[model samples]
Target: MTTFITNFLEVFYVLIGLIMLFAGIESFRDQENPARIGTGLFWVILAVIFAGAKFLPYLVIGILILILGLLSLFKQIKPGNIKGIDEKVAEKSAQRLGGWIFMPSVVLAILSIVIAQFTPLGGQIGIGISSVVALITAAVMTHANANTTYHDSERMVRSMGTAGILPQLLAMLGAVFTASGVGELTAKAISGVFPVGNHLLGVALYCIAMAVFTMIMGNGFAAFAVITAGIGIPFVVAQGGAPVVVAALGMTSGYCGTLMTPMAANFNSLPVALMEMKDNLGVIKQQAPVATVLLVIQIGLMYVLAF
Candidate 1:
């Protein structure tokens, strides 16, 4: 079962690579982007890494990642001209589909949850399987042909540009930080100023650290690992706090930071770009107050319940 699941994941990765390769090809053909070569090369490198990383040496992968960084540094990775959606066609489709347009998304969410909970394939495989199923559901509902679907998908991917890969890069950074004992260094630094055994202080420290780290990193999952290791386990959990509660609240606390940061391009910037909003920071502005309140409430809850 594990092997099967592993193989399924590999196939999924390859599919993703192929999609990225297609995006690279499209970028090369786009006359609008002045840096089309750089854009295409970025995606092609990413595609190669995704499809062939397992077979490649770690040093080779590292070099490829450096190349990607250099490309970004030189401002080569721009989102070229994405094909605009036809408004009349979109409106007609919207009128025809109405609420049913959301059905595929609903299926994707519910089916993923069901598979993860009920099947031996686990969450990773469940997500991959559910995504494909949802794609098929969307195709059937829209009565779309393969070419149309591919065109739409490619457009969306191109529109995302570098932000699409930011999460993966941040996650890798988290792993590298943890591996380098950054967590231990953090714990040592914080322990000097604030005593470790105080429950309220410990909870506050963990929660605040999670939020601040997430804000800096732009990813809650990335912040969770480092913060949990550095502050959560040592400061809160070790001090008689409930491990599970601390961990859970720690992550959500990080999400509060996600709501406030521009670094989180997918959550904050993507909507503005997609909707053509005048203010790029509008989403974060709206979310900030809510995130702040939630973070404070979660901190209180963690203090009360985790202990």
Candidate 2:
């Protein structure tokens, strides 16, 4: 089962690589884009990395990553001429589908859980399988043909621009931080002035650190290892807090940061581009109040529950 899942994942990644390769080709053909060459090269390089990373040497992968960084740093990655959505067609479809338009999303969530909980495929494989299933379900329900699906997928990827890969990059950054003892440095810095033994203060520090680190890094998962190592275990768990509660609340507290930060481009910026919102920060503005409330609530919850 493990081997099968591994093989399946490899194939799935290859398929994704092919899609990105096609996107690169489309970018090259997009005459309207000023940085078309750079954009095309970006996708093509990403495709090669994705498809061949397992076989490629670490040095090669590192070089490719550096190149990707340089491209993004230079503002070479841009969304080209994405076709605007036809309002009339969209409205007609929405009216026809009504609440059924949401069925695909419903299926995606429920099916993912069902597969993860009941099957030997596990959560990661289940998520991949569920995504493909959800895509097929959406296509069938919408009567979308291959060409339509292909074009829509391409446009969506293009619209996402560089933000599409931010999560992966940030996750990698987190791993690098972890390996380089960033957490230990944080621990040393906080230990000097912060009273670590006080349960409430420790809980607050842990939760706040999670949120702030997540905001800085744009990923809760990335923040989790660092924050938990630096703050959670040393202050909370070692001080008699329940391990499970501290870990769970610590992660969600990070999500509060996710809601408020523009650095979380996948969540904040992608929506603005996709919806063509007039205000770039509209999503973050709407989410700030909720995030603030949630962070406070999480800190309280951690204090109450962890102990």
Score every model by TM-score.
0.85, 0.81
What tens digits encode model 1's per-residue C-alpha lDDT throughout 1-307?
Answer: 8888888899899889988988898999999999999999999998999898779999999999999999999999889898888999989999999999999999999999999999988999888889999999999998999888878877887888887898788778767877898877888898999898999989988899889988998988878877888899889988899998998899899999999999999899999999999998999999999999998999999999997
Report the C-alpha lDDT of model 2 over 206-246, residue by residue, as the tens digit: 99988999999888887887788888887899899999999
On TM-score, the candidate that comes out on top is 1
Q: Which residue pairs overlap in candidate 1's backbone? A: none
Cα lDDT for residue 265, candidate 1: 94
Quote model 1's TM-score: 0.85
Which pairs, if any, clash in model 2? none
